[model samples]
Every structure is written in C-alpha cells, then in structure tokens.
Target: GIFFLLLFIFLFQILYWSLKYFDINNDASLFIEDLEFQDKLSEAIDLHEIKKSQEPAFFNPNFISDYKGYALGLSNEEIDRLHQYRKAKKWIYSAHEFQKITLVSDSLLMKLSPLFKFPEWANKQKVIGAKTKQQQFSEKKNLNDINLATETELQRVYGIGEKLSNRIIRFRTRLGGFVSNQQLFHVYGLEDNVVKNLLAQYEVKGTTKISLIDINTASSKVIREFIYFDREAANGILRYRDSAGIIKSWSELEKIENFPLDKIEIIKLYLSL
Candidate 1:
C-alpha cells in the first residue's frame, strides 16, 4: 500500500509540472501575437495624414503626449532631462554640438540637430563687432544700381524692409528681373499703384534674350512684359494653358481679359506665330 501511495504522488508531481510548462508556453505565444498585432496597426496609420488633419484631436497636447509615450516609452525623468538639455542650448546650434553631448544618442542627435542653432564653431565665424562694420559696408555698397544687384544686394536699398527684400529676391529668381516698372506687380506686397510710383525711380535693362512676343510658349516673365500683366494675370494665363492645353494661336489671347487687342498688336511683332 505504501509503495502504491508513493507511485501515485510521483505521477501527480509529473502532471503538475507538465501543466505549468504548457501554461507558460501558451502565455508566451499570446504575448508574441499581441506584439505583432500592435506592430501591424502602427504601420497602418498614415502619420502624414494625421499630422495634417485640421482637428485639434490630431495635434492637441494630449494626443502628442500619448504619441510620444507610445513611440519612445521614455520615463518622465528622461523626458524632463531631454527638455532641460534643449533649453540650455540655443535652438539653432550645429550638429557637432549634438554629437559632442554624451546624453544624446546618434540617431536622436541627427533627428534634433536641424532645429538647433548653428554653433559658433561653424565656418566663417564672424565677431559681432566685425560683422557690424561689414554689414554697414555691404549696405553702403547696395545703394548702387539694384537691377544689377543680387537679392542680398537689394536688401541695402533704402526703405526696403525684410519682407520686401525677400520678395524682390524671389521675383528675381523666378522672372530674372524687373524688366519694366510694370513687372514689379509680380512681387508680393508690392501694390500695382506702388509699383507704378516706383517704376520711374528704378531703371531695369531687360537682359532676357527670349522676348515675350517671340515664343509660342512664353514664360511668366515674357507674358508679364508682353501684356504689362500683373503676377495674378500671368499666373491665370499659365493656369488656363495648363488646364485647357497649350496656346494654339495669338488670337487665343482674346480669351484672357488682361491681354487687350492693342497689347496683342504690340506683342505680335515679337511672337513666333
């Protein structure tokens, strides 16, 4: 009877061990499946679309907090440390500074480097006092003919604000230059009347070999010079051409209101067709 009881106890121990092992295996499998499911769901989300969404739910503080928590799994202390580090350094610091910092990882540094201030260690390092003299000289130099000058040069023109300076630079890049005083209308914030007032003051020699009237496919600048059209009108013509297809004939100019008969006649001598 004693031997039978011992044999029974041994069998019971074996059964209990097997059941525990099976339970552990099942739990592990379940955990793996859950992880995979979450990964798939994360990949399915369109991050760009979510970022662009108009609703506060997409960009609100609460959503951002949840998103950071899910993606980084950073502790509150770690997050606070990162914030403190960022605050101590200028927002515009260079990538080198990021690399030098021991607390920041290479991947994280690369991601954050673009937002930081360019370090004083960067090339062409200029002293503050030295820069003032150079800037004064540059401004003095820019007071010369603006038509021949670069955007940086144009900034020196008296009464030209930062916004206006940027506009001039952009216009120069797009259309090449202010051909006629009329072309200034293409610049943002420069009102037509203001342009008309300023046109006589600034003289621009047209250097573009492609005359407005010469080509079947005229650029925005050519169209501007041809019809004395504003930026809006030039854009309208381009949009119309794109939508309806190419301009088949000069007579098609009639369809565009800004292209008057007299202007068309004046431009006919210069056109291809």
Candidate 2:
C-alpha cells in the first residue's frame, strides 16, 4: 500500500511540473506576440513620421523657389519657365495660368496646385479665369473707345508713359483712326502685355469711314500702303490677279505660291475683291 501511495505521489508531482511548464510556455508565446505587435506599431509610426517630413509646404505659385519647386517635383525647364514669366513682371493668378506658363504635366499640376496660396487680389482675379494664349476679359462699363482714347487716358495704363501715349495717338492719326484693335500691335515699343491691358480698358467701338481698295484693280504700290501688306505680298497679289484674270474669291490668292493668306482677315479691312 505504501509503494502504491508513493507511486501516486510521484505521478501527481510529474503532472503538476508538466502543467506548470506548459503554462510558462503559453505565457512566453503571448509575451513574444505582444513584443512583435509593439515592434510593428513602432515601425508604422516611424513610417508615418518620414512621410509627414517629406510633405511639401504650401507656397505662392508666383514666387516658387528652386528648392520648393524641386520638392514639388517640378522639372528644371518648368522652373526656369516660371522664372522667365515672373522676370517679365507677370503674375500667375490661377493654377491654370501656372500650368500654362510652366507647361507642367497635368498630373503634377493636379498634385501641386492645391498647395498654392495666392494673394487676395489674385484670388479675386480668378473670376477673370485664364487662357492658353492671351487673357481676354470682357469690357467693363464706362470704358473709353480705343480709337478716340486721349494721350492722357492712354498714359493711365501701367506700361504706357508720355512718349508712348503720344506715339500711340500719332500712329492712330496716321492710320486715319484705328481700324482694328490688333493695329495697336503695329505701334513700335507696345509690348503684348501692355496691349492686353490697353484692350481691357479700351476697344475699337466705332467704325472709321474709308474707301476699301479694290484688289483686282489696285496697283502693288497702292496695296503696299497698308501696314500688313509688304512689297512681296503686294507684288504676289498683283501677279495672281494678272494670271488668274479676275480675283473672284480671296481663296484664289492662296494658290499664289508665296502669298500670305494668314493676314487675309486683317488685309480685308483695307481691301476688297
């Protein structure tokens, strides 16, 4: 009986030690799992911090520094283009204008545009919108006639001084009043931006009464009198008129080898078939 009791005690001790070891193993596995979860969480937090550090700050699109542009993922050429635009004292009022100036890719523009912070006036100028070419805004009320705008009024525009204003008036008088708004471009020293500003305030609202030159009968010298027509274009028109017999349609002039059909619309202002 004693031997049996001792055997039972030994069996009970073995079972208790085995259960204790098993419980310790289970607890160790749980601790390992917890430590692994903590490591993963720390890695995630570090990754988030790195990403936050890499994010670019908001900036004015007009005044993008080289480093800021690089951080924004803009190419060297695109940054140079922006610099050249601002060098001319031009302003970028919208993301569209910024893209148009820099020629940045649509995807990059989409990503960077949201971070642009423009001035209050620039934000208000958004109502004018932007275009790929020149920005053409509608004429406001009480705007003066460009054809009759006085030297004083012309001087009111930003780029035009006393000399430029007088020159503009002289050119208009020589042309017997401006036939088209584009004629302003013909005036020497009138920069495109200045012309855009001028046109925004004034326009060719009145028609100047003048006899249109008959293209079929007018001499080359007479044709050359118009600012758009040069000696070559004038001679080409005469040659076409001679060879084609009668210039029925203006399109026939397109076949005149070297004739400039590009200026047809403006030339039509002074000539007729």
Candidate 3:
C-alpha cells in the first residue's frame, strides 16, 4: 500500500508536467511571432526563394522553366520528350526539328514555334561566296540525283543544312536509297515546302529496293515491322493468309479490314506473293 501510494504521487507529477507542456498559449501574438521566426529561419535556409521574384521575363524557350512550359500549354510529356531529345547533345535548329522531337501538333507548333527564337546562325545560310538564297543556288548545281548526292551536295538546297542534310541522307541510306520523290515526304523533320523544294532540286533516280517479305510465309512480326502494315493490318494479312490462302495480289491485301487502303500501292513495294 505504501509502494502504491508512492507510484500514484510519481504519476501525478508526470501528468501535471505533461499538461503544462501542452497547454495552449492564450497570447496570439506569441504564436504569430513563433510562425514569423519559422518563416525567417526557412528564408535563411534557402536564400534562392528571396530572388525568385526577380527572375527575368521572356527567357529563351530552349531554356524554358517549368512554369513557362506550363504557361505555353506544353504537356509534361512533351516537355520531357524535348528534354530527353536535347540530352543527346542535339540542338533544335528549326521549328520543324522542334516539332519532330516533341511531336507537338501542328496548331501547337504554329503557336509555339514563332516564339521559338532560334539562334542567329540557324537563319544564316552559308554560301561558298554569295549573299543570298539565289546566289547560293547559283553557286551549286541543282541536286539531280538524291541517291548519289553527298551531305554537302544536299545542303546546297535552300532549306537543307548540316542536321537536315544528314537526316535526309540517313533516311536515304536506311531505305537503300530514295525510290521516289514522294519518299522525301516521309523523312521526319522535312516540311512540305521543304520537300517540294527538295523534289525540285533532287530526283529519286535510284531504284526502289525495299527488301520484300512473302505475305503468305513471313511471320506477323516481319509483316508488322513494315511501315505500311500496322499491327491490325498485319494481323488481318496473316489471318487472311492462313484462313484463305497466299495473298495472290495487292487487291486481295487491300480487301483486308484496316489495311490502309490508300497505302496499298506503297504496301506493294514491300510485300510479295
């Protein structure tokens, strides 16, 4: 009983201190002052916050801030794609290339690209010894055969530069060579006007040399890998080939559902039997 009494006294002392420790202060200004002290301590911890209000207006889009990207209506995915693309040490030299990297829609490209403000040299076309677009063309012969032209020769075209010329040649190489002037339209960043100009200067005199796949025999993977045959179209082709027989002609391939009917002719260039 004496031990129990000592325990009660100890507990009472502990409870009193706990209650006093957590007692709500009635002095409102003290609470406010405590908050103000915390505010000052946070400011001292991160001084950069103090200068955030002094950030510049209208920074280059290449240096876009998160707030700027959000304000410009760029989705986080689009901004991330642009950043990932830029991480490759590549620069967006033109609006076309910017659109290619980010895959922003046409309306967005038009709205955003004008404000892009590419560096000055991007606008400057270098000529061996000339002042103007016409003079540059005059110095170089029109690119007659796109297949045989070097990157330097490709660059002679008004719109083609180092990056674009490499891209064109790389596409040409990938396809063995450009089979038609129309194929130039398929290069990622080439604009329609640029393609038209490319067509004017260059001709796809090289042979159409797409490595063909047998429609009846090739696996779905091979069929699907061809650009003309999307997954649905490829599956249809395989299903039809298995259910009916070898796709005897382009007409038969076209009859399959979602076969990209308009691209039938293009498909013919890649498939056989």
Task: Give the candidate number with the greatest lDDT.
Answer: 2
Better of 1 and 3 by lDDT: 3
After superposing candidate 3 on the true structure, give the runs of residues whose Cα lies further than 4 Å from its correct spot.
Answer: 1-143, 207-210
Q: Mark the 10 consecutive residues where model 3 has the least summed lDDT.
A: 121-130
Prediction RMSDs, each to the true structure:
22.1, 23.8, 15.8
Judge candidate 3 at residue 196 and give its lDDT: 62
Give the number of the best model, judged by TM-score.
Answer: 2
lDDT tens readout by residue for model 2, 225-253:
76556778777777777787888875565
Give the TM-score (vs. native) of candidate 2.
Answer: 0.46
Candidate 3 lDDT over 111-212, as tens digits, reads 877566654333331211226768546634555777888999888888889999999877776555666555676677988778767766777665545677
The collision pairs in model 2 are none
Per-prediction TM-score to the true structure, in the order listed: 0.30, 0.46, 0.43
Judge candidate 2 against the unseen true structure and give its global Cα lDDT, from 0 to 1: 0.77
TM-score, cand. 1 = 0.30
